[model samples]
Target: MSAVGANTSPAIGQVHVLADSEKELPVPKRQRLGIAVVSELDSLKASSATKRDRKRQSRKQKQLEKLPEPCSSDDVLWKDIVSVLGGEAIDAAIEDGKDVQAPLVLQEEVELEVKILGSNGDGIAVPVDSKQPWAVVVPLTLPGERVRARIYRHARLHSFGDLVEVVEPSSSLRDMSRVQCKYFGSCGGCQYQMLSYESQLEFKREVVVKAYQNYCTAILEENMPEILATAPSPLQYGYRTKLTPHFDGPSKSVRKGSRKPTTEQPDWLQIGFNRIGTRKVLDIEECPIATSVINAQIAPMRESIIQNSHTYNKGVSLLLRDSLDTSVDESVDRLSDAFNKHICVTEPKSTVREKIGEWVFEYNAGSFFQNNNSVLPPLTDYVRNAIFPPSSTAPSTLTHLVDTYCGAGLFAIVLSPHFEKVAGIELSQDSIRYATHNAKLNHISEDKISFRAGNAGEIFAVVQDFPRDNTAVLIDPPRKGCDEFFIKQLLEFGPKTVVYVSCNVHTQARDVARIVEEGRYRLESVKGFDLFPQTAHVESVAVLRRVD
Candidate 1:
């Protein structure tokens, strides 16, 4: 793994530690995230709890509007003023009649050394010379690089910039590393392609660690629970089990050089992944990250869709799912046929089967299945071992497993054997339907496992019959992470152990920190899974045990 600026110091001033914890290290100001309220806050006609939230947000905004405006004659630094009062308090000081903070104007081309990577994989560079209270975020640039950038617009805490040139490339960029895909720069499907496979693993691990440092106050690096090194996927590229490439209509493709009327050429049917930083779909011929079978069908499918282009009035996303076996070809054929039949239908007319270990899971083509199938075995196995250690049977106290947000019973079925009984709860009826079917398909007795659907708020209510001291709860929420309501419910349920699996580490850190802060559980361990190897995303699992 390449060390970004291994020998060099950060170009910015001294890092300022934020809180009272001795182990809490000073963080770069630019990387500090803040909450922003939307215009939707004006409409608070939803639930009473939502109205209370809106009122609190309104009060916070009003407070920010009350602070004195910065002036050149003032003795205090703008950052110092904001930092002293805290970001939210300062935001509340914004002028009441005006919007939040005034948008910052762009500065001319300037050379800045990239200090660190931001949440979205952008290189963060603080302009030590500028008077503005913002850092420049440049995409397609790496930390430790000196780059000339043109500032676009200043956001709440940082300015967005366009990279002009890498004045001094990072060691990683200067190395023999090369992005494998031809469309690496334009395709939004994958990032971190520029880094070697080993470097990518390290980068992802660092991302998770940094997230915890930023949000989780209870755990410090020295005394923190073990964060096991990321388990690398067996296959990096061509590991994705499914691909959904789409095109917007009026499908128009221009025939080169021929002055033929625009309508004569295929109705500009551009189908593929969205271009990086934009919703525009690039006509991708091949995607190196997608499975081999999915790649094989792209060209023919594009041709077939264009040939019958008249049938499609609106742009549509096509699902190409691989069954991941010797029958992959047949499976692709079936999906392609389904696409042809349901060309306009949003839902595909088929379900695809994926086998992990001895179990085969069949779900709809577009539904959620772990994208990186190669790493799922280890990922699930790790969760099982974390929840049920080898010595777990010694107590004979733990009796059941409760899976919240259980999608199609992946963990419930996998962990069922170790428990007396397992219950899977999901908000989606379709997911519950499939989860139940999956259990039956795997021949798990109905008495041993059951599935429930609708209103996750009641998830714990049904599982309350089981002794809290004998139950383990598995929560795998969506990317935005769990809501406070659910977290409160989980704490109330008071399971013996709570396992949280998240795709977004920042939010995971936030949720996990809150759970720990409740003084009911201690974080046991955290591990990252390279589920999406080439992307800036990591699936992390955090295990917390109830305080004895």
Candidate 2:
């Protein structure tokens, strides 16, 4: 062996490698499998590519999840605004890290400078934006003022917002004295105290016309009687006949460890109007809208309740009604005497007495009465004459009349002389009792005029046997309007005529639609009474005659 070869030789048990021409060196297993190495590299690349694809897909899905859901088509987006011109845009901001380009391409953002065109205790409307062209309604805004508003809710093309700030003021803003009460805005007793009386009438008239034309799809003829043409209340101030006060509680510890006050304090609860634009009752000691007598007794009543908290529940609502007959002061002697006679013998009466046509009604302080007392006679007369037109041929053969929802029997007692027989139906037991007492006070034959206590919707069932041809029905439904059952029964009973009195035009229109659809009655005459000044509330009467 050579010296270099011997030094390189493997020690002890190690093997030595040598190349020879005849014998080939053993090949390693890894070197012999070249395709396996290439396949393993390709497999690692494919797995990495799949993981990258999955991560990209997950990122896209997360972006898609951030989008807002679409709104319903019938959603009332701009109902808060009360404007005729409809052009407004939405104001919105893009989220951080969001692709602003996507929203910018699909949605438009606009800043609107608007003037409050009108208000109906619900919302204010501003002219639409020329750039955006969508109707917008703003809440908590008054008419005749300029405001900057940002739209929050969007619909098809329209948008709505809340009043941001008042830039310009209206000419009709109430002077300090004109507001009359300190709590004008807080108490919400009157919405139009800030507006002049004439302006109030104009606004109300516009509201009526707008509601009829816009919501009801009514075609009002120019020759039709104007709703605002009627006279307003003779006394705008102190016109309310009834007032109701709520009590919160007094400071007193009724029981040990209870959350009751420990010191004696004046009862903070009393009769008052609801908070402005809300249904909550405001704790008011006095209300300027109520009559003096009603205001005078409020503190005493509160004191009485507070002193006898154990006897009187803390949560009870107190009411004061006016029962005196003031009709004689107006030189309406016939009506005055009728009311005095009817109310004189009844239980203790309140302070206000109103005369409608030839009938006088003495109501409690908290009872409901037509606010526009001056126009009440004419309004009632119009209804009576339209329904029971004095028989030109024979006055004695006049048709019999039924007054449904006849609170205090004002219609029944006043129209008793014109009808051969009259009946009044009311749900309130107190109202029925008052109606009966009213007929007696007028010295009218109670036998000729009967009172029934039940639902007005079921009045026809009670009087279905009455002669249909010679009978007329007078309905003065609540603000919500008569139910479908009442309309159906009225049609089925088929009275000669129906005089519908309503405080809401939308419900009135719905009821009229039902009547016309039944094909039993035709619309004859429609009239409106501005009983509530400075507010959108209006009283309307529609006469429908049976088709022959």
Candidate 3:
């Protein structure tokens, strides 16, 4: 299935309106949503992206890019839009089981007012002139904004387009003053930078609402709560602790001890990210969303890459992670002091330290950890309060917690004090090893806290001995969410409370629908967290309490 949108609509390019791959199992539906978006993916803890799952998703992505799957009856989002916009036109266009002519041509230019925004932040519009039901997916657009986009790829019911111009912008949502990036329309790094920060939060909340509306059809509409207001990031800009600036030096593979005879290096290398709707790398000197330490490192790093361009083959991303001075334990308590003493680490294996509230986390610079450090305190607080509410005696109420997909044991270690016992389940032994070491580093006792690596599908088998009624399971899976097998096991294991945190709400809704399918549990609350403030991405947490 060609992912019809970007991961969160901020990084939009190569997006397909319809996905064709129902053949691949384990690759969840929402995994099929953001195809070909640069893999600068966030590693939200309690995440489900094990090595095997990522490879499967990577392989599936290749297959999707090779073939565009036509929209089927079950592709509800596409079908609903087509029915709403192009009912008669679709019937007219279809002849002998295929459209006689595509509503828009390749490279055809058209100015269209966006009727509404898709869940992924693309503006969806129907051809008003032709009264055509065919839809166009345009990035960097908002509803009620008339924009000119060039049609690039056509699917069965809709066409994928590149935003060419915004002729008439929405009065309310469009505020040119808020757009800080000079490459607003062209760069794939951001989408909602044009809108006010307040608007961006609301828009992301709306995304959560739309995802549930589209994917959670199995659950009765009246039963679900309105998505809570999106929590704003403490700092909107210069909050990103990590940045990966990349460039293509030379295509010749770098082999050990190979003579560097003649791979001619290009005079200029675009040392940055992908351009909007294309794989071409765009040169970015500074990122407003990145921290001061990371921004300063870019120049020196780019200089090094350029200087050593002749020695390299293939494109490479230079990692710039901000590490705090952890030498003094007291400095970690003061956020400003900790941030003032920050170090930039370029190597993947180098240690990156982050202070989340009072707890400090240490992880490999290359591996996945939450990029936004500012909002983590609130994010973790929300997770903690969900089980042990501010009004209630939490630790006394819930004695045990099982943090599944607990990468580097962020949740387990953070929430350890509140629980009588905490078990962190992960597929990577290395992560578990890190978790074990982190517990000791944080002065958490091994008797009260534990970390183990287990297969995702059968993770509960490792924690089968935990008292179900006294336990809560904390899951923050990847964009795809939990597979059917894992969901089945979850319902069977039947913990007292289930707290699911997700980066992609579409799959979260899909997974939530399954969890509540048998009426064993009821969704109590759903809240959106603005981990990445300037972008379209929203980290959502859904709390489910057992009813039956």
TM-score of each: 0.73, 0.64, 0.80
Worst ten in a row by lDDT for model 3: 65-74
Candidates' RMSD to native:
19.2, 15.3, 17.5
lDDT of the candidates, in the order given:
0.71, 0.59, 0.78
**What is the lDDT for 105 in model 1?**
53
How well is each residue in 285-333 modelled by candidate 2, as lDDT tens digits?
7777666766777777656655554443355665666444554443345
Query: Which 10-residue window in model 1 sums to the lowest lDDT?
Result: 31-40
Best by TM-score: 3
Could you give candidate 1's per-residue lDDT for residues 367-466 as a string of tens digits?
Answer: 8878777888898899888877766657557789999889989999988889888999998888898899889878899999999774755667877678
The parts of candidate 1 lying over 4 Å away from their true place are 1-108, 127-133, 172-177, 218-223, 251-267, 324-347, 390-396
Off by over 4 Å in 2: 1-119, 126-144, 148-165, 172-177, 218-230, 249-271, 278-283, 302-314, 325-375, 388-398, 427-430, 453-458, 464-466
Please state the error at residue 485 of candidate 3 in Å. Answer: 1.5
Worst lDDT window (10 residues) for model 2? 69-78
